[model samples]
Target: MTVHGADAVDAAQSAGRTQLVVGRSDIVTPLARERARDTGIEIVVGAAAPAPRPASGPATGPVSTRTDPTPSTGPAGRLTSLRAFMPGEGPPPPPLFPPSPALYRRGAPLPAHVRIDTRAVGGPGSTPTSGRVRRVTVVGAGNVGMIAAMRLAESAAIDEVVLVDIAGQRAAGIALDLSHSAPILGFSTRIRGVRTLAEAGPSDYVVITAGKARTPGMTRSDLVGVNAGIVGSLVSDAVAVSPDAVFVIVTNPVDEMTEHAWRTSGLPTDRVIGMAGVLDSSRFEALAAQVAGVHPRELTALALGSHGDEMVIPLSQATVAGRSVADRLGSGTVDALVDRARNSGAEVVGLLESGSAFFAPGLSAARMVLAMVNQTGELLTATVSARGQYGIDGGYVGLPVRLDRSGLAEIVEVDLTAAELDDLQTAARHIGDRVGALDGAGAR
Candidate 1:
């Protein structure tokens, strides 16, 4: 049989058979004809013409032949070979019958295109199919707390968020606002506000931002008696509602308040953590960006010890654009940058003259919430109870902790300078004093 396409012709030529039956309809050039002749083979045009009935004898000229050894017998086979036919052949073998409808119709009761409602399989109006429906509860409805509730409601991993506040109206208003934004945020989570802690029962996580804000000229230490009492009450209520929830303390004096929360909540040490160093380090990064004239993202740093001025920033480990801070701007400038970082919070407080920062602090709390909900085992420096991890005991301190689905997974002990260690101990002692003050108040 004659091959029409260039690939087919090459394939046939490669097979060493130089002769080929071609139709008059075929477009073979004189040069190809000459080449075929030079190869000792006949290029017989119209050879595909049906034989003249045999003329009652041995077929005249050369009987039609198929170049392929296995002649086609099926309809598809006939179409593949049909292009080799001479003109006046009947309609090119009826153009192989359209793919069998029976083949597509087999087995299934109905075609796949038929839309079948899956709700019937799982019962009608059941909660939309999703992974385990995780619930989060944010305690407090102040700025930081509301912002955290909004962020959690925007996350896809959490299915529900309960916002609890002592002031029922405030929590309800914030929750309503968050719920209204769900359509815009493209999240399907439900946001609820409640007055009592009972509404947040057995949540996957509990974020405590219920304490009072820092007034002007007040150190986080100054918030001890007031915020500690507030944190203690909130912790007690939260523990009764969600003993299993991972408690994240975001109150001022976080290191001290976290210790109070753990003691009052009676949760395991691993279940209670405080948000401090991450926010502190964020401030440091911002200040480093100001000095280095680069994006804040390019600055790498860590804050340890407490959440206040006593918090130790590891200057030796700090870097800008992968170069050490000292290398980028020398030691004197680096020291100034460190001081700026250490005082950034106070600077903001001074600017506001009334309120502390909420944006970065809220974002920091949200990051911790996401780490827990998504089960991302990220190492973050959070305030946690010190069981003698860094030679400090009976207090809370900020240290790198592995956060995962279960909350505080592990505390990572990093190498520190002698001065760094001593400063951390001093900060811990400061926090211990605050905790002791709260304890004394409780005695009264």
Candidate 2:
């Protein structure tokens, strides 16, 4: 009872019946009939049976001529039968799956099962290709860098992670410890520790987090010179070996270091970015919750500009329970909240007394890596090079950017008040001074 392709013709020849049905309307009727006769199977072109009407209808009035019974074994029989059963032209072929309301609401016109023929649509290099991970290397072995390497090894997306550090033994020990945990975690990703920068070789992504941690007495400006020098050296080595790998800068004075790395490495601007504003914004959200007396998850806040005291926290744009915080708390309370937001990092360091915050910073770095690996193209605040964006130029600063596998895609611009603008400019000047100082020291 099952027929397939040319085998259907053989089955017809074996059967005593001389009739064949060609369902394809595109095939010329006469041509099909001829082919059927040549194959010794008579073509029944229009032998479809007519639909029966219900007998319960009253015969009160004269029936129209259109309702007349038609013969079922003529050239027009199929068309007549189709007209009786289906009023208009027969229904078009059904879609493979039912439409999803959610998808439709989101502006996706096609159903989930509607397959696109990439072969037909794709030109030259437009076709989708698989990615291979031959070797993975990480630059820096500080808190963010270590976490990035560990997370990358654990990710199914990459194969291995080579952890590099100035302190070689410490890096090796960390790698060894992470390697031991892999067995219990059920991940097969390999981890290696490299003493010399050259040992890491070419990598898919070179994450930089090797500078000193921020202390309570210091500002990001204070850490700029030391971190810039460290980042500059790391960038030089990383670019020499892994020219194509994306560079993620997570050092303190992130904006300055990121810019220095870009300039030092001579890589494209898109390849160098700093991780800060995302973490800072998360802190802002938490603080907003405390001020509003609500769960942190329900509060939404934005922290823009430099990742320091001069950073801009837009209270006018912040909201809780679908209402602006400015409206809820008025101007004075909002100003206090902004002050709290600006000093939260120092507050955390004061509370710890021994170390700066790590969990949130580590999580922020991991999120950036995940966004890149997944090609999600999500918009987040990261320190990136600027060419006259928001009236700032020739520097790196925290701004919202769309990130994906290709690195920074686009920068999002936000409105700033006069006071916020002044603060940001001051931060930029402070960073510029530190960079100048480092250059002078290097010259000496």
Candidate 3:
């Protein structure tokens, strides 16, 4: 059956039909596909209708410049042969089928359109954006960076994600692998790999996961010196190209590295951030969920302070189904969860023996980047400058903040017990000491 334009959709709607089936030869206009998606009308393409025989008469049209001596006998094949086909000469034909119906749920409403800021440059005579042209760059191409890049590309929020590494070919290989998966994963985000940060320039956000990962016996603190040098240089180079880009620091000793990045980039405190607390909070939520016998989504948890042994998980703010976790699982079990959350990274390192944790860390970093680019104003834990929040005067600390394209939009202050506040202050002081040592070593 031939499917016309949006009229077909209107006709189907009027008929109370939820789906339309068309033959392969039937033409479904672009407007029809869009209308189907908008109105929850499923379009399925079946077999092609057989081409009818031409009138039993000689052809009257002008003869082709070239003749095919061995044209096929089939009517459809003959018709195709008669046409003057040229490659790469015009717009491609639309797909016979639309995207999977799951994408356009039968009863679900379409996603709300995001408002794009027209003031942002889109070249000389560009129209307002459709919120699909943002770019992100993930430096390092290591486990963490690779996972982060994959997550970002899979998000499909940004138009492109450039993966950079010192080993250019390795990055390219990883990008190629991820790019190959895009068709299967159903994302249109472009992935590119490059040797230099220069090629990843003009990015909207830069995620720095380049650093010496901790081995089985090493603590995150042990990576400070080695990773500081790596992170500092990457931030400097990235800032030179992406001056307005938000820098996400995912290197080890994250709080200290975040401070070093902030100081090195000479960008505003809000622009440079660290991915630590979110991962830690996720760990805490997972453990709490196990104990509470509830899905992790049902539990709201927050882990603050530094991202190391000194990390503090405040029980006051953690709840299970709106009830305090402590009340649900007692203070004893909750304390045990807190301790485990603090040492979760080391536990993973010990378990892997050769590599540190990357899955959660990369996902956490990607989540922060998505929140920023989408301007979702999501409340998240990030390592940002401590401007006297929680009585911590300087240095970077993990705190709850709202994220946007410009990075940290607001530092959300939640009520904490006196003991929790003390622990947070202690963690802040530890981070400050580490950052000071980096300064002393001129690693900043």
Candidate 4:
């Protein structure tokens, strides 16, 4: 049957047709090809229908290229061959089986009329990008990274989550293990693991958790120098494939490592962020709710500063079911809760006697990533560059921020008590000192 164009193809598709058969004379539009590619419909045009093989398989003979001369349809005669499959050297494969992008990408010359859509291809050209991240790449594949990948994969909005790490086998194994739960979880997000950042392909967002975990008796500050190096390498690798990717840094010292990613990638200042405030604030709210005898969701807590012991919790700002937590728990209990919030990471470290927290950190990292991908403009605490307000310049520190697809959409500075402001300043100074040292030592 004759078809006019994409509209006809759509009509046919709506009528439950699974394949499109066209002659060499037919004009198959690009939209038709694109729709076919997306809808998994086979296009069988130009090529003669294949002859059925015998029960025992068809008799074989030497194959040779030939042309059909019996009848002419289109201006150009259909090229035929003795073999069942069409020759690879002939005209484009009816848009049914287009040339493998791999051929053009591996230094292989592109065939005629087959220029790579740099926006559609992953490698060997401009980095692929679209409106927002259907794909989230998680760097590290450690406890936090792995957990974040799993959480992202569970999101219905995400199409893929690629986990890349230096530990290739481990990453692959974890990916495979998580894949088994796809049926159980009823999610369609594809999860994969790769050894190299390039193998993760291009992504709209890259969540980074690729750094050494803090040990017992250690502050998040202690990981600054070593994690800075790791973050620099990871950010550089990610930027190579995903220049526009919004970065979510979860490594400690998160403030400094986020600064490293921002500087190393040279992306827009708003595109790189550290994930401390969410985890820290979540910890605070949970502890506050626990003592106040309320649901954790009813309490809202904010932590300003670093992700470590020096962080500040404005108890005056905290609310439990719309009332001040200080009013509910009194000043003394609130002080202990604040201290616990500051030292929560170390507390987890001590309990495990090895690794630090992953559950809460992973939850926070995933939330930040989704906020960016979904462009929710949600408010959360994250480590961002210090500039514009408060006069703190040239370092990363925790602050309440409005997050969206662009990363740190807006920095929200809540009214801080005098003591809270001093705590934030002290944390900023420590981060500045460490980041400054990194710059001086050329570790950055």
Candidate 5:
């Protein structure tokens, strides 16, 4: 079929054509251009008469928009590399996809003065579909990724949850395994696993878990150099396809890696958050709940600063049943709990003798995913660029934030005690120093 309108474009793609000859009457629509890009089909428009179809396979050359007499007026479509002008269609395009500094350009930050409206934020625990979120993509179908993918599928908020990994067959297998559970779990959300990032398409929320895990006797910092490279490449590739997607980084050395992601993807800092504080806060809360003889759900806790051992767990602010933890538990007991929370990941790494913590991390990832997908105003902890917040500049740190569909809606700054404040300052220095180091190496 000669490609003309949207229907013909679909028909050509449906028949698996390598190239399409543009007739004098054929008009290319936006969807046709997109399909051409996705399938790498070269569109040849005739100069004077009807253009001829190419040989076989895929066509390789610049798509031309010369003095060809196709009858369109105005822009046939977006003036992009793969798209060309048609002679039909009138009036100019109304400035489509105005480039956001966060998207195309680098070194720009989200405006600091943009006020966050509380009521506009979505409810985290609210049942699904109050917004436009339809798909969630998890990069890296490893243990943390697969489990996180499963949790998103179970949420019933998204229509499709995609799992992408470099290990093609293994990721596909994990996706297949989770897909089978949908029937028993009573969820309509489809779970699919693929080998490449392009296959995931445009996702509302992208949870990046595609990096190395900490092994026994290895500090989260120890995996930084390797994982930074891994996270950088993954973010670059994933961002190419899902340009509007919000990123939730779950890779180790998360604080540094989060910064790495923001710079590499050149996305707005708020939309590229690291999943350190949520998992760390959950651990702290779970331990506090156990010690205080309360359910974890009953305890509300905040773990801020860095994501690792240096994280600031403000016990004075943490409460269970509306009662301060400090009032219930003595300083000695609370100190022990904080130590446990800081060492939680290391403990699991040692115990497993191979794999690190999966269940808790995956749950942490899912909780964060829910907050973003539902546009929940729920105050949660995430690692985002610290623009002088807690005296941290030009680096990413874990802190309390109100999440919404737009990602970090507002940075919730709870007053910290002198000691907690000091800890946060130190973490800022640590993260800043390492971020500077990464910059020197051109890691970002």
Candidate 6:
């Protein structure tokens, strides 16, 4: 495989070249891309050159006279004439894809070959009903917040997404970039950026993702004190303008942060939800699917309670193709999957050595927003007030919650074994202690 490094980019820049072309399979280094961006160099992917053909005849001219005893047939040999393929050096390359068929004229009758299906597939009609637009305010321009805003905008369920960050320029840049992709991505949802929450008023949902990210060797609980203040302040300010908006907290130590947001906003217990359980459950499902040799989308898994070590993954509930995970993969594998899922965030953080996971967490938050905006009433695991459920009281715990336009519609109680219930309660108590300490220490 071809390896594209920063040295090659520097060489191209030194040669006064504005573009660097590499094979499609070439491994482009991150530093190369960064350098290219800094130097205004456009990196283009090109097709691999054809293998060298064996000599057909004896040496005839100077071109065929000088031949090395050993010939090179690697990337270097293939790229010896790369400049021939460069723009303005030769004829234009062939089209990568065939042109789309001209089906019909705009303003003309339906084409004879086209037949429309009158059946209703799903969802409400395309446009918002009565122009009752829905808006979501994402508080943060961090990795998780940026990805969450992108996912929410792509969903086409919300009319607008406002990204709020203290770094106003960064937020605006990200918003502008995402907005530019809307036409190409086939989504019309508007994306905007602002420096303060006041500009994001009357939002239907406020997703709280502003907080310290977990670094290597740092546990989610380690961020409790630092994130509580940030999340609490954002939630309090969010409620001032969008009092009816549901608050989805994505800050670290999410279970405790959900409680903090709830208290700060003084909203109903059902309105403030944490974004851990869904992400944890998705991880569990993906891991279980890998072990069971099945597609992850076909597996149903639930991870509840705290978003940290005490997170509970019940063997009785997790299933693949309607079969219990324990029965399919045995208890030992289930245990391993549970442990992996519980520590997946830390695993990513350790690997990155910098930022915690954002892709799954962001999508998880966006999924909750989509459920709320579309009023799908889908049952998803999330952290909500558990004052009387599972014999746990006075804390926000992760559980199966049905979401709709009204936010939390119902808390679905599933039958868990005694041990599973104990584990869940253990997680709840852990979150409770951390949350209590936040208040006791005057964190927010």
CA-lDDT, candidates in order? 0.65, 0.60, 0.72, 0.68, 0.70, 0.71
**Which residue window of length 10 is worst by lDDT in model 6?**
98-107
Write model 6 residue lDDT over 171-244, tens digit each, in one string: 88889999998877677888999989998778989998999999887888888878888887888788999999
Summarize candidate 3's per-residue lDDT along 328-437 as a digit string, tens digits.
99999999998998899989989998998999999999988877765543457889887878888777899988776688887767778899899999998888888888
Every model's TM-score = 0.68, 0.65, 0.71, 0.69, 0.71, 0.71
Instruction: Judge candidate 3 against the unseen true structure and give its global Cα lDDT, from 0 to 1.
Output: 0.72
> Per-residue lDDT for 257 in model 6?
86
Error of 4 at 356 (Å): 1.5
Give one clash count per candidate, in the order shown.
Answer: 1, 0, 0, 0, 8, 0
| Tens-digit per-residue lDDT, 1-444, candidate 2 | 111123444465566444444332212222222233245443222343433223642222322111123222111011211111123323432221111111111111212222222121112222212243555566667666677777666654566778898784878888898899776766677788878669877887778878787777877677866777778888888888888988888887777777778879888898888888778878877776787887664455567777776677766446665356778767788778778777777788888876677777766776676556544333477888767776778667777676666678767555556776666667666666666766666721
Clashing pairs in 4: none
Give model 1's clash tally: 1
Displacement of residue 115 (Cα, Å) in model 3 is 8.7
Candidate 2 residue-wise lDDT at 45: 25
Worst 10 residues of 2 by lDDT: 98-107
In candidate 3, which residue ranges exceed 4 Å CA deviation?
Answer: 1-130
Q: Write the per-residue lDDT of candidate 5 for residues 353-408, one digit (tens) a residue.
A: 99899998997888887877755445678898777777666778888776767788
| lDDT winner | 3
Q: Where does candidate 1 clash, by residue pair?
A: 1-67
Which ranges of candidate 6 are over 4 A from the true structure?
1-132
RMSD, one per candidate, in order = 23.7, 17.9, 18.0, 20.5, 19.8, 19.7
